[model samples]
Target chain A: MADNETLDAKIEALTAEELARGLDIFRQKLGAAGALWLQTCVHCGLCAESCHYFLTDHEPQSIPAHKLEQVASAFRGRYTLVGRLAPALTGARPFDRDLVRAWVDAAFGRCSTCGRCSLNCTTGVNVPAVMRAARATLTEMGLIPADLQQVVTTALETGNNMAITREDWLDTVQWIEEETQGAVNDPAARIPVDKHGANILFTVNPREPKFFPLGMQASATVFYAAGEDWTVASEGWDLTNYGLFSGNNAEGGAIARNLLDSMDRLGCRTLVIGECGHGFASARWEAAEWLRERPGFRIISFLELMEDYFRQGRLKVDPSRLTDRVTLHDPCNTVRQGGISEPQRSILRRCVTDFVEMTPNRAENFCCGGGGGQLAMAQYRDRRLQAGGVKAEQIRATGARVVVAPCHNCIDQLMELNREYKLGVVIKTVAEIVADALVLPTITPPAGEDHDVTS
Target chain B: MGDAGLRLGVAICAVLAAVALLLQVVRTRSFGTRPPMAEAQGSALRGILYAFGPGMAPSAKESTRTHPVVYALGVGYHLGIFTAFGVLVWSMRDAAAGSALPPAPVRQVALVLTALGMIGGISLLVRRARGPLLRAISIPDDYLANLLTTAFIALAGLRLLAGSLERALLVGAMLLLLYIPLGKIRHCLFFFPARWNLGRHYGRRGTFPLRH
Candidate 1:
């Protein structure tokens, strides 16, 4: 990853040769499904209202269909029959420097690739997939937004996007373990680290250690209450993958491989991805696609695991503990893209006394305007905040005191939105809320044996 | 042109359209569907079924529910196109056999469908031309495609209801058929697969047949 100066110089120096290379990458990435999506769009414009950007900005350029037209037009210009003969008739344009810049703006800055528009598209066009394809081309051309590129570069070079050192991670985990012990009132309770043959190997967003160690303590407390065999790897513990956002499959695959390798080394049978939406989706749904092989171990979201614990009588919660009006902001990757909608709602229902639903929730929920790596792009901060007005209003309508966003990325954006919009809402992760509502059972230590309090 | 020339021209145009559409399909298929390497959390078949079935219902999609009139017009327009094709084939067969128009009931049904289709097509065209959002996104091909299809439907209805202007109807059919593979109208060839792909994606991830 070059400095912004070098990247800008490269963009300014782009020539027809570079344009051809970019177009070649685009053509390769536009697989059959992508081609179908591009060809199937009828310019119905119904997808416009489905987008938070379009709703907030009210700009025609913000419409998903129009934003994708950059890619679609270039694809049609080079590939389709009508476009080849009469490009203007089909609105096809040659891929050039201007188009490259447009791709970056639309694919990265304007859209979050939330798939809300995709779901509502009358033609069933996978809008996010197309945007991702556009992003992939821009990435190959070294045209990604500098801040977003920095995140992906950092994750690839370091083990995590936040670049938290191994020592710092271990120290945070140890401190959180102590907090968990006190919360559970048992010295024997442990946040196990690198314990071989653990049933579950847990992963977390690096933000948990860097900025929100209490989230880790909350998860550890939940694990203790459930008496579960779970271990967190000191290495490869970061679940959030910036590769998915940057559209760099090789880097994404490397990140996923690190986690899988850690799981194997720890001999954990199930990989539990913590409350990171894109991380959960990337690991659960896309890791295999990137790595081209499925892992022997099962991958599940922490929410799902918690749900299982409740179902099997391994964990209990008292909803009366959380009396505040709570609303769950479904992360696009986790609920819409990852298919883990019910477990979170089920958990919320069990853990919160006053749970309110967003008007269009579950698979239909609007994004918090933080996805697709928007939180990392400082250049687009105003646009990102503006787009998030839709989500802020959604939260305002619920009038919930606490907005529970399971994904760390969504949490960050929602926090910013809380300040920008002055919604006066506290943002929380699922683990924190669930930990608040946990009902720990009393266990007695046996004489002459070291008490395994969890068991 | 005479009736014989008109029939021959329409026949040739239909064959050309079919061939062009087939080539497009083959080209699209040449790209090959990437088999998802990830283990399935749910069934792709179920998702695809839902996508083509209940997923298409007005209640299932926000766009359709919000813009019921547009969705309804689009649906009626497509239904009319399909119905008109059937009528065109039947009428061609009758003409070739030197027979009168099909039974009065069949002609009446065709008339009703073609009329509905023409109305839907014209209304949609107006919406596209008038609505700021739609107008911004639409290309010239959109207008041309809509006009050609609506004209074809109108001519088909006239032929069925009045039992005249067979040549004009045939010419309209020929032009519309020729344009099918060249413009935005080509979505007809990719719509099913597009929906199927969308369904399979969500289905395999356990997102479709939404559990909510």
Candidate 2:
């Protein structure tokens, strides 16, 4: 990828003609459902409370309806009959640079695309879907926030968003494999890489190797305990997709295709996305649709796999290790939008001695304010922290010593919230907690042998 | 306009609305070209059913639960609009046959319901007008859509109750019918499908039948 300066120079060089191209791109991105949602909004303003931005900032623009209006107005001006005949009557505004910038700040900077507004919208307007179209519009013009565009560029040019080299990734795996062997006291315990024909080809958030390598080690340990045949590809190991966040489907497709190609070459039958919530949602639920390419293997979150292990007696955890009251923070992408809600809770029940539920959880939980590439967008740092106030308060109310979020992005935001709010809590991922509580069997099971330890 | 002119306007309005509705359907269908091909974890049918079912109840949504009065008014206003449409169609039939109004008791009930609907609609209009956030978000279509439907309900109520203002009621209803296809009021057609889409989108993902 071109360095940040080059990317910025490219974005700054965009012309009005190129920006107009954005509108055409938006027209392409706006699906039938999005059009219906755009027209369906009744301007009720009841969706305000559903947004963390609105709840925290209390700005009119923070309201999802008002935020949507910035894009919907442009859409109506260019497309709708009333807008064409009498723009004022429909409140349609002609697209301009100022309006486009406003849309960027509103759709990308402010909102997290948590889908909360759509859930509470009286008219079912699907605010996030409209906002995503706006993001695509801005992205087509090369007008994305610098950090976000940088991440997308890096992911496109390099294989991972963080641009971690092939040697570095292999080294991390080798290091984590050693740690797993030491902890399990078994030389056979391994964190395999580039093993073809493995049943599971696991992918991790680039942040895992970049910032939190311990979580990666924890995941490897759990897999080792379960005696699962899983391998992380040296290439295409980054599961986090900036393209999904930036609304650049081409980039998203390229990123997803790389993973599919990697899995195919490795002959993996199942792809397991490790503990990164949005990555799991993007790859498992969205990638194929975004790229219009179906993968040959079944894709599932590692949380689901961990839950299966508990049910099948493939892995056992002694919940007594977790003495602190624990709570699960539902990552919006994974829990609400991705349908992986129960699996995490089920895993937590077996991994923790005391697991408490956050009120208004599952699909209704407030976002950690790190979604939609908000964590990577440095421009919105303060706004992101303020938006996390709702989540911080939710955690305070739970009074849990440990907050287990399955998504790495949520863990990042929650950790900041713990510091800012002084909640005095420890944040950990489900895999991390599960790995801690795992009780390895005395006898190592034979390879390819299926044994029910409990049943 | 007199009865003949109003009836002619209503005919024209009906044709325009049909065309507008057809165009919208076609445009939306084009966007709906791609069907979901992902491996289903749960039933979209069940999720859609739930979305339109209990999912729509006031208790099901946070916005509705916290703002009961607003939700109630909105629901009541829509019910009134549906009831008024039935009355308009039935009245149009009577006008064609050169007959009088329905029985006095039925007219009285219609008058009460239409009045209630009018109250609900006016309340919503007032809320929009007063709240700065709402006013900021609203378009001219928002006010016009509310005014047309509210006026239709009010005129219908007056005609049914007083047994007078027949021409005014017919004209108001005709204007509303004409504007429905052109304005935000067309949500009457789009709302159910939008809800169903949410249900299917979230339901197939097993996000619906919301887990605790």
Candidate 3:
């Protein structure tokens, strides 16, 4: 939608339109739970132990309810009486720009906005609504984090966050195809980029090209084996939007638009967000909504895709492919926001013989402590590991040797979890499991599906 | 104040006041929970209402099955307290007869029983702190509010235990009443409307039903 601008250029070229648009994200979200968020409570303390961040950090200050209080306190002071009278006593303080900015950063920039807290909030305060309100404020405050801000700017400018040249995207796909072809016996494997009107318009974070190409290769192998016709966008691609994590709702909305518009133009039926956690979480649950419409295509995860194949009897899991004891770490967004507990469990059940269930599994599962740009913030590693302690404990209790996280952030966090707690639980994606569970000389193609859609 | 009168009055009033406050804290503690840094941001007045709770309102999302006990308890306890509070706030004459509102015996009994009920709640709060399940939740305020309020009540209770005068205890009661408008205790006045509004709003949004 715009041209590439370096960080300095972006700073120099900031327009009133962008400024106004960014700031409005906050106001639009305010009456969000309409300040009912301001009202509901009994202060039961039931949610204290529900959060991994609170538990691991053991900072009484970090408790989910206490964190929620910052907003609640503001709401009371701004809108109600007792807040006006005894603001500090009741913990309700008058809202100022600094407080608003702090809230924006804490809720949007710092918090995963993961909705995990809401799941456990006994009052049903909808912490996400609170978080959205804060995010809206951040959107207004012009406080978007630079990393995500840049990604959004790039996506809006060059049609992709990584600014991956068309040649590079094509070359990456070709490289994946070639890698999969060499590794497996599937000579007919296809890496379909820019195919129009396909069932799925699959996209991934540019990190796949930049750092983790095997993920792309592995996914291509799965798609090739499954005989699915999924296309990648020639431009306006890459599904990852760090902006959403960083609390830049406008940026989040914009990045989403770039991808959705491409999918719409190509007339794809579904948008399969390849395996990045925050990106998948952003595009599906949030960005789509912010754009004022459903996404151009139904967005499904690779885990969902695998579940479909397993359920439909299209793919066979040999079970012997994985010798490690595996447990699934349901990404908070997928499990909590997306309500994907059933499909995730189904996929895990089919592939791993030794599947261990963490106590608060499913939607109630702990965050990677790395979601919501936490991992993206390399500076926050100490806090991340400390916050991840509970999860590390849960994994250790399972005695599982490996963690099969379906999201990228979860994988990274679990890696850190393993190292910090010394749990020795190796982290992997569902694709990694499928890659192993798959035992053919190559993924055996269904009948009459040898022709590449790209052909 | 004579020792007999002072001891008796302070003991009874302190017990009454302490129990009332302890109950207040207990009741306030039930208004959902504290998530990190996210307190309910209703105006201070409304927040105080929610901390006290509106009398026995049910949120829209509140399922009859899951909340059957709560609904029953809330109606009985909060309604009793509301009725008691109404009588106390309205029935303010020195004499038992010719008062504009219901007399102190009825109000006093309501207050005392309400205090006892609150004591039960405070006891539950105590158990929450003591129990392993909730020990980690035993925060400074969680424990302090109940114990402090209980002391005020215990002083009143000690007066009741000793059968002591009424003015000093009355002043103690007044002091607490004044404090309610300012302290975390303000939830006493604000919890009801705040929670009801929160419930109703979320309910309307189809996320959670408004509590009636």
Best by TM-score: 1
Provide the RMSD of all predictions against the true structure, rounded to 1 decimal: 2.7, 4.1, 10.3
TM-score of each: 0.96, 0.94, 0.69
lDDT of each: 0.88, 0.84, 0.59
Candidate 2, residues A1-455: lDDT per residue as tens digits? 53334445555666777767777888888888888888888889999899999899889989998998898888888888878888989888877766776787788888999998888888777777788888987777766777888898898898998888999889888877777777776767788888999989999998888899889989998899888999999898888888878988888988888789889889998999988878988898889888786777799999999999888998888999989999999998998778888889989888888899987798888898999889988868899999999999899998899999999999999989899999999999989999899998776767996644331
Worst-scoring 10-residue span by lDDT in model 3 chain A:
A1-10
- TM-score, B chain alone, candidates in order: 0.93, 0.91, 0.45
Candidate 3: stretches off by over 4 Å: A1-28, A85-89, A96-105, A108-110, A439-455, B1-116, B121-212
Candidate 2, superposed: residue stretches over 4 Å from native: A1-16, A443-455, B1-5, B30-32, B96-99
Instruction: At residue B87, give the lDDT of candidate 1.
Output: 68
Question: For candidate 1, what is the DockQ-based docking class?
Answer: medium
Q: Sort candidate 3 into its docking category.
A: incorrect
lDDT at B92, model 2? 72
Rank candidates by lDDT, best first: 1, 2, 3
- Identify the superior model by DockQ, candidate 1 or candidate 2: 1
Candidate 1 lDDT, tens digit per residue, A1-455? 43444556677799889888888888777788988898889888989999999999899889999987878899888888789899888898888767777787789879898999988888899999989888888888888877888888788788888898899889888888877777786878898999999999999999888899888889999889888998999899989887888888898999998899999899999999999999998999889988989899899999999899889988788999889999999999999999899898888999998999998899999999999899998877899999999999999999899999999999999999999999999999999998998888765556675744342
